[model samples]
Target: MKHVLAIGAALVLAAGVANAEEECLEVGSPVGAFYVADVTGPSAGTKLCYRCKFKDRPVVSIFAREVNDQVAGLVKQVDGVVGQNQDQKMAAFVVLLTDEPESAEGQLKTVAEKHGIQNTPLTTFDGVAGPASYKLPKDADVTVMMWVDGQLKVNESLKFGELSDSKVSAVLGDTEKILN
Candidate 1:
């Protein structure tokens, strides 16, 4: 009985330590911030930052090469759900990964407009390094990271051409639980 109790206590301590080590962006990771035209906000430009902004609200950040119809739909649904839950403080952002971000803005804007996901903040980041900084797989085309109170809550990835309806719903459900 004594040995069993000791082992249980050790396991509990290890779990606590593991959770403590898991932060949204580890110290020294690139800030990965950029300014972009607002699709919904009244402001002309909004500076989206992984480190500075969304301090208090739970942030669902989608890192993708393009905001396709499926991705936009998922974000729209999650945004609506979060909007309905007044008790939950949350924000959604799409970080487009591209080599030529300036040129890609028009395309991203069009995609957002087409899918009616204008409410979500959309911008572009330089390379895979941005997503990798958050520990996403190098080959991942889209990675969703949800953070609450500066802690890492969810880090999910979907390969290029792999964003299915079921996967999107699962991710949103996970985010909902975290916000709750």
Candidate 2:
């Protein structure tokens, strides 16, 4: 009976370890990719704080706080892509601001109207709420898109592969144990 109980306990622990690993694989990081796991204060201001491993390269990260000041920051980020390659926009910006989801969606639509970002070659879905998803670009397999989930009331993306929820919660969670 003692041996049987020990075996059962071992199996349970093994299952738990497997689940924990699965939790991180949902979104799928690239080979040799790793996230910063933690950082100091947010970068700019909009809650973008993340440091993700991106396969064989030094870990890559984005600072959300920097986004609170959107106009200059967005321009710089998108333009940074252009500057780096000087051809196509290197990254796509998915702006998620506003204290409320409705307001955030409204702003996206408004910006699309005024700035003509609607349904263009690059610009896909407008600001709809909840369960929002997008496909990975062929080249953007290396990049990540960040947005707000007003329903779950968190920030997440399809980019992080398996780490999406936890990573997002780290950004939005009220818990003390977060990277930054």
Candidate 3:
């Protein structure tokens, strides 16, 4: 009876901790945040957020679908490094923001022609805080984000501090709202 009681107590405690973590938007793995976006499908591999800690461990993977071949290819590449919890099994398209509004608009139209995605712009006017918007297929699974550097980027700025120009790579600052 005592053992059973102890097990029950442990389970309760575990559940509480899990709940707390789920609600703790800021506290999550190095990969994209679990509670950030409405991620669906297979799962993304290990992703690295800017504010992630060294000891962070991945817990979930978000795999969006409906993107073009380019988007799917990017997702597969990124997920490959996410290790165990990677949601690579998932597939999808992702809208990508451009380095600049004009270029983004153009690319959206071009990519759409080949991939059949409709481009949409996020038109950022926050003045050095947000990125100008570009549109892609609404169902794209690739993680479309912005690069404050304008028009083009050498790398995807997953971490906030990496923004050299007053650019934002995506709709989110961190994993905080990506899962929404």
Candidate 2: where is the Cα deviation over 4 Å? 25-79, 86-89, 95-100, 105-180
lDDT for position 54 in model 3: 14
Which candidate tops TM-score?
1
Predicted candidate 1 versus true structure: per-residue lDDT over 1-180, tens digit per residue:
999999999999999888756634553333343444343333325544534666757777787766677777777786676666546657777777777766767776777667666446677766645644465455677888776666667777778577888888888887754576
Q: What digit string (tens of lDDT, one per residue) describes model 3 on residues 57-175?
A: 21112122223453433334333332322342211123233324333434334543443322111121112222112222233233233221111111232332332233332322222
**Candidate-wise lDDT, in order:** 0.66, 0.30, 0.29
Top-down TM-score ranking: 1, 2, 3
Could you give the C-alpha RMSD of every candidate to the true structure, in order shown?
8.2, 14.8, 17.8
The candidate, 1 or 3, that scores higher on TM-score is 1
**Model 2: lowest-lDDT 10 consecutive positions:** 33-42
Candidate number achieving the greatest lDDT relative to the actual structure: 1
lDDT, candidate 2, equals: 0.30
How high is each candidate's TM-score?
A: 0.70, 0.29, 0.22
